[model samples]
Target: MSSQPETYEFQAESRQLLNLVVHSIYSNKDIFLRELISNASDALDKLRLESLLDSALDADTSDLHIALETDSEQRTLTVRDNGIGMSRDEVVQLIGTIAKSGTAEFARKLKEAREAQDAAASAELIGNFGVGFYSSFMVADKVSLVTRRAGEAEGTRWESSGEGTYTLAAVADAPQGTEVTLHLKPEDTEDHLYDYTAEHKLRAVVRQHSDFIPWPVRMETEKPKEGGEGGEGDEAGGTERVVETINSMKALWSRSADEITEDEYKEFYKHVSHDWTDPLETIHTRAEGTFEYQALLFIPSRAPLDLFQQGARRGVNLYVKRVFIMDDCESLLPDYLRFVKGVVDAQDLSLNVSRETLQQDRQIQLMHRRLVKKVLSSVKSMRTKDADKYRTFWGEFGRAVKEGLLSDYENREAILEVSSFPSTHDAEEQTGLRDYVSRMKEGQDAIYYLTGESRTRLENSPHMEAFREKGLEVLLLTDPVDEVWVEQVREFDGKPLQSIAKGQVDLDGEKDDEDDSAKDAKNAERAQREKDFGPLLGWLGTALAEDVKEVRLSSRLTTSPACIVGDADDVTPTLEKMYRAMGQELPRIKRILEINPDHPLVTALRASYEKDSGDAALTETAELLHGMALLAEGGELKDPARFTRVLAGRLAAGL
Candidate 1:
């Protein structure tokens, strides 16, 4: 019980964090008020919960509320709360030195959630990070905190400029609560941050960010006196100071769906997501089973700019028993559904649970699984009930949903049902796998697809020529993730998802009503072409040995001179390029070079090789054909300069 004033240096990490808070912790300075208000609400909640367990603690103060006052002339904003406060030593520990274990554990949890893209976990750990109090330094030059523990004889006064050191001393006869005063920085006021000192701005911010705060947040304001009279003996007409409760003090998620309007949900979404557009979908659920919780989830109409950024902030606000716990808890939903925005308030969880504890909480895991199912169900409903809207959703988040096929094996079937892709039948329209299966040709057993950089390119690809000629539909997969999820989803609805660009194209079906003679004639013609091109194939295989796995007469190609195909067991060229772009290196797999037997270039080359099997011109032709195939497949040749020179020589020779 040292009553003497004591000055102490902040812990090393605390010092660093203090510096970050003052300079760069938060992007928006107005959030400082939100942070303070949230902290005040938390203190009140802690006291309320403690009173339930210990009746003696409630003896002094039964009223629990937060008061916000602003002094424009003094450039100070004060937030006072009548709740559980701290003694001198408690002040030193809580305000001066953040617990190393708690800070480290919270940091680790945040990093893990971010890395895993666990938006739910990230959101739930925000206020638990032990840094909310420091956020005040973002807009304030100096901060003063005075607090008295419940039933304690004295309170503590803590002052800091947020530099490196802080002062603490005990005060006698202090109230049983905490009051924090922030001395706004000159630049903050000059930058118009003083607007927060205005009553209107304060009201707007409170309603926007903390409308659902369970306890009343009161603010004092001056209003015109009724009947234009101050009082009986007042000198002149003046405004009267009145206390107004600013927050709605109602947990919106706790309300029944029948009671909440669409507009209210949209406003809540805007408050949480900071987005202006309406949500594409809203899912509200109140689970009353063994682990009770209420969730209100939203799917935004547009993708966020950071949706693809690794470990981006994508979490829903988390509360327990109507008490705000954290924002951006990443564990409540799976990583693939990071675009979902909303709040989850659980009655089964402890309000005092730490982030580290939440990482292993069974209730969180159960809620996470439940939430993923709900979100996917809502998306599926959108696809069936409103296809055009679902298409809009797919355009924005299809890749992320497809990624679930790879990461969330349990939900792959559900995710697949909602996926859509461009097809050869329609350049502008997209089709789901089920629809493609329904339209399958007679005797067709495999679902055909082609992956490339774009729909227009894939549709015109030489690899798809045979499928197009056969009147078979081919799905044109243009997304970068298409190659990945396709591998995971080898087949959909019992038919193999065969890539037209990979392996060999086989669209086996019932034969046409051609006469036996016509069929025999066609077979004889193919036999002759293969025999005549055998020598050329042998010569080309040797010439392009380093670049190709094997060269053979094409059965699939109908127009282009040559095309490349990956081995049935190897990665496709598109996927190989994607891997390379990501800085990953896999052993390069050679491509099978297939030459169109009907193309004029192959016919002439066969005739040339027939005359002289060792002709150098034949070797140059083989190399040029391989280069053209590479270029057609969106591949880069190792020797572009040499290919250009060889091309120029060939064109000159033709002249």
Candidate 2:
């Protein structure tokens, strides 16, 4: 007799996730079958690996495969796999609760994908979120799973209505492998709706999604005899029930690139990435060295919606000798290349390797370094062979690639070579550092750049005024990561990367027409201006002493009244904002305040300061100039309200 089923409430988060999977993630309902099959494949893989370690678990490992059954009248579809089944406790933990970390982030990405109608992103998100099983709730109102672990005598049956609760019971005659039977909803039977109970639909979905699954996926179907002849015990004119294997059961990565077609590569990409769009680049490598491995990598045409989420899972599907080890093996690639999707099959890795073991494995580390070089080479090829496609790739994942500049010190040069950026010279297309350097002024010594949150704002920044006047191109770096990378990438191709908002900039390099007389006159005029304004400079510096490192005369500014410049080792305003966003506390660094010597506003301020060095008006003008400079450089004012009050008072007095 079966034991009475014990009831358990679904975790609050799991219940909300169920509703989201069923209603919101609706781009492709056919993914339910794919997810179920993939889970079944995972179970088989686990069992296969375990059987190798423990002989007792190999009792019935001879015919390892998956089976599908459909019942039209009963309104049910069953997917059974002769693989590792869950124990009672395992079922309670894995099925009953959403135990994965980053549940909130997963839910947020799902909502964003659904709202954007990004079908590819929504589909890829399910597997990464570890909620593929809950996706079964998308089609079935009720799902029942029964199975017994390979070494266990008793089997557990788990049933859930996806309505906040589930039931579990012990069964005596349950199979050794897992069997999931879904009770399709009423709408699933309506016209034009998907009929999961149909054998043809099941075959098509299995072929499309699970064709490359290492194990055979068989389905039972009834076929009529062409001739009126009976075979063995079959009736002469009746149809015969026959089981046919549907999947190719071949590992795509195990094959040579010459044997795989473009269409096959695309189909495999869709299966692995769950992306409806084609890949931007495909890389296939077969390395036969001290550690042998086959890698098939793809660069997607668009970035995943959750690409930047904190602690987002990365890396490719790891396989050992055609046996699937894990969905994501983070050790295979660096975090910066997390957007890459594909499979890595190594013959050297143990089938029973765990995440921790993979991390410390020397062979794995060697393979990782090689793989990084291969991916970088592939990207470099794309940049050289196809500029348009490379641009598309850059548009999608350039910021992610930029992280490599900061983290992967060894490959920084190659990454910079392929990197693209928007520049002050061209607003329509992205410019490479090589192109920017090639177009540099004859005497330009540094590659000038400006970092900000937007291109439009960066273009109008007072910091870029002198660079623009000198016809010098400046790289417009808008990505938040750019600020961090620029620090690490101090120079590119022997030219220092100088921020237009930082340090002194000299573009007057050896003027041909400037003889000793011209130089003398210019120096004399500059000396006189400094002598005449020295007291005024000291007074203004004292007025804004707390806000600036040093208030000095400017040579970099042409038209702007004042602009803020960082010291040689100071952080950019953009970097400061990023640090605050990450909840980090950094030592405060004051910026240098540079006043344009020729601007009318500064001239007037100098005159007023000379008239009365202790005047309140002079102090107000100094504070106002500092506030405007801070605002113009995209830095926030420490006391915007007070600045506003001072400005209002000055305006009121003028009126």
Candidate 3:
């Protein structure tokens, strides 16, 4: 192994993030101590768990704890933990590269939060990204770490000044765990970054943030001797260094809810989640029967910056009888509920159970089912009991929760009960499905909806014209996932989910309310129009056969002269495009083209064809009409140059 210290440049994104953190991100710099202590507690937890798994491990298991030491003279603070530390390679891989996967995205979100002047969101981003380690830069000018992994003889030391570079070197004789020493900056009372070296300040921070930590956080304080008397002039008779535990070490989840204050819960959430904002909601559930587990989960106030990023770390920590088993135990909850943060402690789980086994274990599955139901129920309660918080929750996590409709079959209906979408019924507020069903038209048998890139797009779509004319409500779904889940979820509350753009929609119910004579006249009018355009429709369909499956009269179009429609079972054009964008291979799918018989464009085209069916200009008009319909529905033309050329020729001839 190389004994010389090696200097490395920070990744570009990491360098940018470091500059932001050191200067702008944190308003309450006192939390820097909180972050370091949380990390120490985690290290102690890991050591305890590793000892349980590896009986022959060489490290000491007797005194596993975290220690905080301060040097007032040097303006420094050190957090020490006798736990599973890191090897030289692990240190290089973990700390040297700050968020390896989404550093750029993390930096972008941080920059946005700063620009928006949202300190809470900025704090949440740092916590959720597992870059809490870098927060030391907020209070310290220089930071150093020395660690020796359990059962390893050699250790590693990492040092950095948050100046776009860090150094790493091997140590022949390092302590059995990890120690992080922060060289604190000069005190700035105005900035609220007070003296971290003061025992009072360190103790207060630890009590607030890590009081419920599972491990004992120790600190040394000098006390006057019991028998010694204080000197009136300058010095005390005697003093002793007493090793004192700073935190309460009270397991918040194990205690009753009434015992813990709201502030305590909030602080604990920040500790576990690394989020600085108060949680949107807290869930506490204890299962007493065959598979016993105590769960304390929190729904975050803001979504993590990487919530949608692929391979983002998710799920909650797992503890077996209050012993840490793993961080992010995905087997405990479904992926759609990944934003939830907390701990689940099981009484009967084997401390040695592998992650693979946990996935297949019957007990874990029961816990998984129970935890998911509890989370959904809490959200449902939020939707009913508190309107403001529920809106905040949805704004942050609605897209993630909607994913459950695809994978969670058992909880599908439960998920739907809490889901909300924008609708034509109300422009300002979103409506739930049940409310939509209740406010539905008297004879409306199917729940109507239109999916597109945006609500503005969906509202203006030609497919929505007849529905709007008939005073029927149509749900507007704009999410990309909306394109998929609608296909999987056929109906909600017994009414089938019908897409207005997919199949032919009949809004003739208004005609049913008319008298018999009026109904007969409307029916006759429709039949006469169809008969007169029957030949023209056939010719246009044959002419545009390569582009459209059929061209016919449209009941869905009232103002628009022509529009595109898909078969009830055919894949949507938007969905087809999505698949193609994902590199999926798909066969060409043709859709129907519907023309409004009342529109002058169609009427004149019919008259011109009747006059001279063999006219070359008639074919150009047919192609132009088809192209216009495609553009109206936001579909791309197959041959843009040809369509533009034909359109220009027609315009020039008219001029």
Number of the top-ranking candidate, with lDDT as the measure = 3
Best-matching candidate per TM-score: 3
Residue-level lDDT tens digits of model 2 in 1-655: 4699999997777777766677764666777888788878888888887787677663478899999888889889899998999899999988888635667677777789889987667766675666777777778889999988888888999999988899999999887889999998766433234888878888888877778888899999878755535556556667777899989988988888888888778878876776656788999998996779999999998887669987676789888888778877899999989989999999988777888788899988988999999988988888889988888988888989898997899889989988999998888998989999898877678888888999999988898887788788989999988888888788988999988788876556425466888878888888998897788788777888898879888877888999999887788877887898889988888888998889999999888777776777877888899999988877788989999999999999999
Better of 1 and 2 by TM-score: 2
lDDT of 1 at 81: 92
For residues 412-471, what per-residue lDDT tens digits would candidate 1 score against the true structure? 888888888889877788898889999998778889888889877887788888888889
> Candidate 3: lDDT over CA atoms?
0.88
**1-655: candidate 3 lDDT, tens digit per residue:** 5378899999887899888777774687777778877887888888887888788988897988889989999999999998889998889898998977768878888899999988877877777677888889888899999999999999998999999999999998898989999999898887777889888888888887788988888999877767656555435548778999988888889999889899998998988888878988999889997678899999988898779988888999999888898998989999999999999999998989878798788889999999999999999999999989998888889999999999999999999999999999999888899999999877788899998888888888889888888898999998889999999999998999999988777778534467898878888988998899999999999999998888889998889999999999888888998999999989999999999998999999999999999999999998899888888877899899999999999999999
Kindly report which residue stretches of model 1 are placed more than 4 angstroms away from their true locations once superposed.
1-64, 70-210, 220-248, 350-361, 508-528
Q: What is the lDDT of candidate 2?
A: 0.83
Question: What is the overall TM-score of model 2 with all chains considered together?
Answer: 0.86
In order of lDDT, best first, we have 3, 2, 1
| Regions of model 2 farther than 4 Å from truth | 6-30, 52-60, 71-75, 89-142, 160-166, 183-201, 221-242, 274-278, 289-291, 385-388, 510-521, 580-584
* Alpha-carbon TM-score of each model against the true structure: 0.71, 0.86, 0.93
Q: Over 4 Å off in model 3, which ranges?
A: 1-16, 104-122, 163-165, 222-240, 510-521
Error of 1 at 88 (Å): 17
Whole-model lDDT values for every prediction: 0.80, 0.83, 0.88
